[model samples]
Target: MRKRLLTEVEGVVAAPVERVWRALLDDRPAYEMTTELGDHTVAYQGGWWYRGEWSVTAHPEGARVVLRVYNVADRLGWGVPLANRFFVGFGARTRQTFAEGLTALGERLGCPSRLLP
Candidate 1:
């Protein structure tokens, strides 16, 4: 079976929900956000792949921009194998990396970003 992992990130945007929603739904900005380093690739409902290393699917629920990211890097390639293994396997490092990616995605979507404490 595929490793099933799903996460939800919620935040309040200073702008109106519709405005924020439009910004996120725009193809160009959405594409840019995913292709940028450290940002996951967001393949829209029926969009094509090839923008980024990983795949992402975006859905808007009212004011919330809910994204599902797939094929995230456990360990980026071309590095010290041992070190990469240690870090990626560690819970703290993994969580931090994922959090950072989510924060970046939120910022690109014009939302103030924060990690849940």
Candidate 2:
């Protein structure tokens, strides 16, 4: 069987793109990025850093957001396979994580959710 490479999940947030971005990186170390307003996108590549993007668009009620996350970069280093098998187990429980994240984000942002897959 072929090994899984990436795990992607999409969701919509009721808040504005800027709000979503701010909430996403909240309570974390300071970081900066140059991004557009509506179609905002960001990437963090510190050893396969979830590497998620929150795509935002105008909606009648609120902005629609898509959160995509998965392993990115540094996949071919020494002992990488061993590490993935031993510690990371990448792609494992990705769907659950995505669903829980969106639900919590919706509640936190005061955006009603529609159940993520």
Candidate 3:
């Protein structure tokens, strides 16, 4: 069985959900496993313990983009906490990267984008 340890971040873009979805598809990573949740959501699982999910939904300003990352480790799952503290700033890095992505997406779509609190 795989154990999932989740970290999430979200942002809003001043564009249609379809546009955001298309952009997400264009930049998706190549993963070992894929799950299509719906027209607006997709998930990819790869490596020994990585899964990423992306989704777009309607928001008051425009479209909301959500990104979720999971450590889906089949083995040594319990080591994640130790690794997180000693090896990498996982959550911080994810947030920084996601913020950059949102900025780039906004530039691509000619719309404004911002991370949610």
Candidate 4:
């Protein structure tokens, strides 16, 4: 079985993209925000990628802002493997983590907190 999770976060900042970008890309606030969001650390392993075994993507265009996250977790099961897989496939924990994490980030960035549809 294969499943994909997609989450989008969008907002507007009173400041310009450059200012917002600095606040985001610069280590100080970003690190603080990560910890506040329960993230252990935030690192850029590749272009436009934040590595902490967790992900958050920022797309800042003018005063508009967007963040997208894609998370994949493998759940391998033993003993009644099929049923266990199904149980893990549709669970609330991962969903809740994504929602809360994104909302907290948005709030930290001075954006209205919301869950994108």
Candidate with top lDDT is: 3
**What local lDDT score does residue 46 receive in model 1, on the 0 to 100 scale?**
20
Q: Residue 40 of model 2: what lDDT?
A: 57
Query: What ranges in model 2 sit over 4 Å off?
Result: 1-5, 27-39, 48-50, 59-61, 70-92
Candidate 3, residue 110: lDDT: 98
Q: Report the number of the highest-TM-score candidate.
A: 3
RMSD per model, one decimal? 8.9, 5.8, 2.0, 9.2
lDDT scores for all predictions? 0.41, 0.56, 0.84, 0.41
lDDT of 1 by residue, 1-117 (tens): 122232333343344455554554453443334344233233422222111223333334324334443333334422333334665654355456646755665677656644444
- TM for every model, in the order presented, reads 0.33, 0.54, 0.87, 0.34
Error of 3 at 47 (Å): 1.3
Itemize residue pairs with steric clashes in candidate 2. Answer: none
Error of 1 at 29 (Å): 6.6
Report lDDT (Cα) of residue 64, candidate 3: 96
lDDT, model 3, position 83: 75
- Number of the candidate with higher TM-score, 1 or 3: 3
Q: Between 2 and 3, whose lDDT is larger? A: 3
Instruction: Give the range where candidate 3 is weakest over 10 consecutive residues by summed lDDT.
Output: 28-37
CA error at residue 85 for candidate 1, angstroms: 7.5
TM-score winner between 1 and 2, please give it.
2
